[model samples]
Structures are given as C-alpha cells and as structure tokens.
Target: MLFLRSRVEYTKEQLFKIEQLRQLVQKSSELDVGTDDTFLTKFLHYTHWDSVKAYQAIHAYYDFKHKHPTWMAQHPIEYYRKLFYATHCRFVMPRTDKNGRVLVIFKTVDAFQQFPDYLQGLIEMDDLIFESLLMLPRVQQNGITVICDLQGTTRNFLRQFSPQFMKVVNDKNGVLPFTQRIVHIIQRGFLMHVTSSLFLPFMNKEFKERIFTHDGKHLSKLREMVGYESLPAEYGGPADNVLDTNLIFNHLSQSADYLEKLQHYKKRIV
Candidate 1:
C-alpha cells in the first residue's frame, strides 16, 4: 500500500497528477485517512482534514512576524491575518488488489500543506504509524511486512518506487528537525521490537521517559505488562545502544520476506 502523509494544501490539479501517476504504476490504489492499520492508529486519536485552513492562517501570521518583526509587534492581529494565508498541503494514496492485500507503492513526504492543524495531525499520525510498524513482530501471519527496495539508484528508485521519499530528500536532505523526530520514533520502535526478548525494570523506565513520554497512559499499560518492578536496573546487558539500527535492518529484511511470501501465496491461490 502507498501509505502517504503530507500537508493538505494540494490543489485539485496536483492531487490529480499524483493520482494519475499512481494509476500508471500501481494496479490499484486507496487513500489512507490516517485510519490505515499500517502506522496511524497509535498516534492520532482524532483527525479532521478540513482544518487545513486554520493552520494556514496560523502559519501566515508567523511568516509575517518573521519578515517584519517590528510591524508584527505593533499589529499582532494583522500579523495573524497574514499568517492565515499560509497553506499546508498533504494527502495519501494506497494500492491494493482484488484479494484485499495491500501492494506497496509510493508515499509523499512533503509538507505541502501550510496549515498548522493539518500539519500537526499528519505529524501525530505519522509518528504513530512509524512507531507501531517498527514494533510489529518480525514475521506475522496477517500483517503488512516491511522491506527496503534498494536495488535501484536513489533518484530513479525514489521517483518510481516512492516519490515522497525523494521529495523529502531534495527538499532538505531529509534532515529537518521534524523529519528527525519521525526517524527517532521509527528507531525507538525498532529497538522495542528486537529487544522484546530482553527484560529489565530500568529499561522500561527509560522507555517511559524517552519513547512513551508522549503517551503516558499507554506506557502505563506496557509497564504493567512487563511487570516493571521485577526488572533489574542493568538488565539489557550492553546491547541497547545499537538496538534501533538492528531493528530497522531486521524490519527491512522481514518486509522483503513478506513480499516473497505474498507472491508465492498469490500463485497458490491462483
């Protein structure tokens, strides 16, 4: 499935262009309203795409303030009126087959939407998805697998495989603070998965502070499941540092395996 997350300022023409591109490459497609099982469930409790306008207003105010600090200081409401003009755009496109199994395609990583509400919602949704996908079991009987199609050159591959990835890279080297936050969420998810076998009390505490801090109530349940009190402070034994990287690589490997299995399953069914 082409799991997508973006700002919500896309014009009808731009949206159509993206849709046409998907149709050319993918056999089937669907839009994820941040409700897909892949990555959005964990983060966004509620979302309203219509709020894009409010976000644009807020951004415009900030832009005006940045450009004319003295004027903004004197006319705050006027500055806010200018901020309202800033629009943030985002959208999603997913592809699936007759059997209802998702076929991975492409995703756009651009913050095309200039509105804050829309951007915030997307951020929350992406983080949740990234975290949940990272934490899923390495292999599952009924789960979307993760994979890294690195066979093609970065440019051509991103264009054909996942244009969104390229947009992010070209826009800012994909190193913006927001991007880093998303990556960190993914990394934490990876560490959680690989180190599920390891048990320690302090480890849970650290997770609560670092990863689960955003959602305290949820972390409380996890802490209970692991029986926090029983874990020793130094229990992870020394392998915790590289846990995130290992998990990411493992997720990619498992995704590749899933693709192979999907092909085989399709053949058998046919």
Candidate 2:
C-alpha cells in the first residue's frame, strides 16, 4: 500500500536513500544504470524509497531489456506515422488527473483483433508511449492510470495473449521504472470475465489489487476515479475532447532523439 505522496521536494531521509541507491549502482559492475538524481529517484519512488528494492528493480529492468531488444528499438517517424493513421490502437490522454496521474487508454477491440500478427509491434508501441510519458517528472512521480476498453473485444482477443506471454508481459511491467497507479478494465460478458480470470494468476499482489473492472453500463465509477474531464468522448467525456492520435504521433516524432538514446542502455551480450 505504498501510495505516492504529493511531496514535490525530497525529504532528508529520502536524500540519504538516494545516495544509498547510488552507491549500490556504483558498486554493481553488472548494472549499467544511470546514477543521476532524476533517473535514480524514479526507481526510489517506484519502490517507496527503498534503495535495495530500487537497485533490484533496476537490475530486473535492464535484464528484461537485454532479453527483449525489439521492445526497446526506436522505429522511424514514418513507421509511427503510418501506425497512428491506420489504427486506433493506443493513446495517452491529453491531460493529467487532479492527482497529476496520466491516463493511458488502450483500445483492445481495435488493436488486438485487427493486428494479430503484430503483437510484438503492439508491445513496442506501448514501450515507446510509456518511455515518452516517463520522461516527464510529474508523470514519474505521480504515475499513471490505464483504462483498457475491452467492450467490443471478445474471448478471441484473449487468445493472442496466452498464459506464457501474459506472464512475460506482466513480469516486465512489474519492474518498469514508472508506476501504474490503477488499471480499469471496462467490458461485459461472461467470456470476458473468464478471460480476465485467466490472467489474474500472473499478476503480483499489488498490481492485482489496483485492477478495477466495470460492465461499461456504469461508468460513474470510472468517471469518478479518473475524472470525467480527463476521459475522451468515447469513454463518456466531452465530444470535442476525443483522443488526438496525431498529437501522440507528433510527440513521439519529437522524442526520436531521446528514444534513440534509450537503445544504448540495454546490456550488450558477449
């Protein structure tokens, strides 16, 4: 239950912990981690300022990157340009919530079903979006909430995400530098319920608890949680406030240089 507090400034104790985490990073020859205050502080906050946990999380992060290089690859601007125009796959909301947490919406119905062959590509797209978001200090501190609209998608959509793959994705997400404050799955149908049940075992306890499901009939809870103003029109917000895929593409295009630098952080296999 280590919820992030609204401490814009680090406390004396946290400053000490940051240095401790820095020492841990410095001592480890295997961990190619950034020791800068901004970078290291992200891990400390993710683990509630526990230096040891932050160090371990950093290790896990780099290890996972080494294993899945495709997820870290920077795509050309044209690649994202085509992807954005072609599909309504994923988009981060244009605004942050009252808590300063960003909202990232995933259109499962459009994405999973439409592009079965591009599952890994979908994952790479997610990484790019998250990396872009995590670049913001406010987003890194407050974290983000995810609203996965699964209303139109069926059990078949779950087929592409097998137990093994679910486990890998879940594990990778757990050690991510950015924290996921909440995840609201809005859907209906007994099959969808069953599909959700199948993936629960792979989740860690903390993440499992953050999940909230809705039947799509009642979005009052969703509206209240993420704020009605923050949601797009598709999710019961103002019509004109719909997700701007073009804006996302533009942001990614601008972040091309920074994303390119991230590619060098992966462990080099001998």
Candidate 3:
C-alpha cells in the first residue's frame, strides 16, 4: 500500500503522458473514461506505475472492447439481478479477508442453467461483483480473495469450457483493479480435477499459482484465514448477518439508474 501511494506521485513527464493518454482515450471512445482519475489509476497500477504503459493498456482495453462489443455492452440491472439468483451465485460476504481485502464467494451447484447465457452471465457478474467490491474502500485498496466452492460441479459444466471463455477470463482479469488476492478451491471434485489437469495450463500463471485446495473437513481454515465472524453460516462459519447475490446485485446499481436511461455501457465494465 505504501509503495502504491509513493508510486502514484507523478513527475512532470508522467503528468504529460497522463494528459496525452486522456486525450487519446477521449478521441478514441464514447466513454469519457480517460478523464476519470479512478479509471486511469487502474491502468497505472496494472502497468506497474508507468504512465506510458498505462496509456498503452488503456488503448488495448479500448480496442479489445471495440472488437468485442457484445461482451462489453451493458444489460438491465434486472438481468444481473436474475443471474445473481441463478445456479451460480457470486455474493460478497458482509466481511473482509485477513489482509483487509474483500471476500467474494463463488458458490455453484447447477451451473449450466439456461435462463441467461452462461458465459455472458459469468462476465457480467465479474463486472458487477468488482463494482460492488469497489464500494468498500478496503477492497479498492487490498483487492479480493475468492472462495470457489466446487463441491458440486457437474461433468456437463466441465465439458462446456472453451478456449475463448478462458481467454476472456485472462484478458479481463488483467484490466480489473485489485483482482486476485487468493482463490481458495474448496471440495476437490471432478471439476477441480479437470481444471487443474487440463484447464489450468491455459489460465494466467499468477491465477493458477494462487489457488489453494481444501476438502469439507478443513472448511474452518478459511474462517481462520479470514475470520469466523466474516464467513457465511453455510460455509460452517459464524457470520449471522445474512447476505445473498441479489443483495450484492442491488448494491452495485443502487447509486445510478442506467437501466432507465438505456445506457449500453456500464461504467464499471470499462
């Protein structure tokens, strides 16, 4: 955190680059995102505090979004609301991780539900979840730790994985702020086995490295890592304050009415 604070202090050349990048983005896209200090700060952080690299990253992100317009396009908050309650619910806990990072729970049972396009729902959820995390100041700083509960991943879901989806996962992961702290894979089922044996090679190296596995008996380890008070009751922890994906969905869209405006691009998706 200290390093980030110190590195963000700009020299004259960096200021010039930031301005250049700002204009470049303004000219290139419909979003007034370049002018946003928060937007550029992500690029700056992702590029290891190099303003030039940050600008390049912004350009790449712009190009990527343009090339994949469908992926970047916004949807109704109601769509997200429904997807939240779908087979896969990625809800944030009412608590933080041991390192003061946000803890996001990815619990799934029947993941291949047909209500919404599975792949697209995953992407949209990623954006909404990150937006929700940013609402908490500590997450905006310390990032998030994911609890990927794979207790009931089906064989059918494993067969649905594609190179395109994996690529999107890696690409989008690079752009997001405070993205990965740790990804705890609880209950090593067949899906986890497939992911490690086949799909792991395709994912980002850092993402692969941070994943830790545990079975049902050791669920308390997560409570120890974060806190018993922070975890949800279903996870065998003591957090009595209830939380659900729908509540999390509401938290992200609460500040704005983009659905009424029919806006095509959500601010957070950028």
Candidate 4:
C-alpha cells in the first residue's frame, strides 16, 4: 500500500556526500570494495546519506559474502543454463513501477519437485538477480518491489516459509546495500494466513510495515497498490507484457563480463 513514494533525488549536496562515502570506502583497508558512483550512492541513499552509516553498510555487505562463501562462488555457466531451462521459477518484470522501482516475482509451483537440487540453484539464482539489479542506476536509485506468487503451490510446499527459514532470510536481507520498498505475497485460502503469520514474528518493524497481501482472485487491490500497467499479463495486465524467464536469463547470459567482475570482487572478500 506504500508504493507511492518518490524516487531518490540527487541534489548537489547528495553528490558531495556520495564522494565522501567513496573516499571513506577507498581509504579503508578492511573495506576493499567497489567505489563506483552507483554502488556508493545507493549505500548513502540506504543510510540517508550519512557517510559513517554508509561505511558500516559496506562492511555489512562484505561480511555477509564472507560468511556465505558458497553463495558467491563462481559455478559453470551451464549450471545456470540448465537451471533456467529446467525450472523457470523466477522472473523480473521487464517494466518498473511509477516510482522506477522494479518488480521481481517468484512463482511457486511443483517445478522444484522435478529437480530436487534446484533448491540451492534457486537461492543462487536469486542472488544473481539481486546483484544484477544492484548494477542498474534506475534500480539503485528507486529500489525494488518483490512479489512471491504462491497461487499454484500446495499447502505442503507452503510449509517451507517457516519461522526459522524466514528469520535467516530477514537477517541476510538486513545487510543488502539497496532498498526493498515493498514485498507483496500473492495467495489465497488458509495457508496464506498461516504463511503470513510465520513470517511476521521475524521481520523488523520497518520491513513488517512494508508487507502487503493479496488473494489471486482479486485484481483491484493489487492494481491499486502497484498499478495494473506495471504488472505482468498473468496478473490482469496487458497480454503483450507477459512474464518471461528467458528475458532475464538472456540478460544474465550476455552480461558475462560484468558477472565475471562480480565473481572477482567476491573472491577478494575476506
């Protein structure tokens, strides 16, 4: 319901603050990280342009990568190719909202059941998508909105959104350098309520307030929240803008140089 905020404004003062944050990052031996304008600007934006807090955010970001080394490991491209073709589980909407915030949706079905190993692949895939979005100036400036579409998943499958698992997710999300403006859960029936209950206890107050839920049958509430024009066709939008996993996969495939650079950066993390 809170998707009406404006995109980040880059005033002259803000630009100066970004430069200060860049110098702080470059000078620190502990934080050997990217000092690109977009990277530093987003960190400053996330911390309200406070250089000290933004520096701490940079440390938190790398600290996460150091703790989860496997998530940052460079696997063969074929692994991702197979994962994409085998299970088209996640897709980032090609369009952004009125505020320039991109919408990332993860549909839940029996796709994972077919490939038991995809669970890990799914996590890695999400990391790739998240990192890819971070590279975009529009995404970095405005932030992102996520929709977990659970329409086709069984109640048994929904059981995985447990308190412990979501707590870990919450902890990890705390360190991300970008803003997550809103999170929408699309589902219906008793399991929807149960899943919501499971996730609420673990979320911090800010994130908890940013969440909104919608039943798959209704389009008006969702449309009012994020606008019908911003959503995919499956969610009662235009037929031409259908959700396509191949588009996202193709973008990542073509970004070999950038992905390689990201791998190189991850390797430098200690």
Per-model TM-score, in order, reads 0.19, 0.83, 0.76, 0.85
Question: Where does candidate 1 have its weakest 10-residue lDDT segment?
Answer: 175-184
Candidate 1's C-alpha runs over 4 A off are 1-36, 39-246, 257-270
Better of 1 and 3 by TM-score: 3
lDDT of 3: 0.62
User: Which ten contiguous residues of candidate 3 have the minimum total lDDT?
Assistant: 1-10
lDDT tens digits, residue span 41-118, model 3: 555555655666776666566556666655552765666666667554677776676677677887655656575367
Over all chains combined, what TM-score does candidate 3 have? 0.76
Across 1-270, the per-residue lDDT of candidate 4 in tens digits comes to 222223455789988898888888788777656787756877877787798899888788777777675555366444688777766778877778656788888876566567775556777787787777776666666789888887666665665666666876787778877766688888887776676677778889988898888888886777777777888888877788788878777767765566556665532433
10 residues in a row with least lDDT, candidate 2: 1-10
lDDT, candidate 2, 48-140, per-residue tens: 888999988888888888776765655654566655667776877777765679888877644554556456667777888877777666777
**Descending-TM-score candidate ranking:** 4, 2, 3, 1
Q: What is the lDDT of residue 169 in candidate 1?
A: 25
Where model 2 places Cα greater than 4 Å from the true spot, the runs are 1-27, 33-37, 71-78, 110-116, 154-156, 268-270
Tell me the deviation in Å of residue 193 in model 2: 2.9
Residues 166-269, model 1: lDDT tens digits: 33322321111111111011112433332221222223332333332212113333323223332112211123321122322233334543322222111011
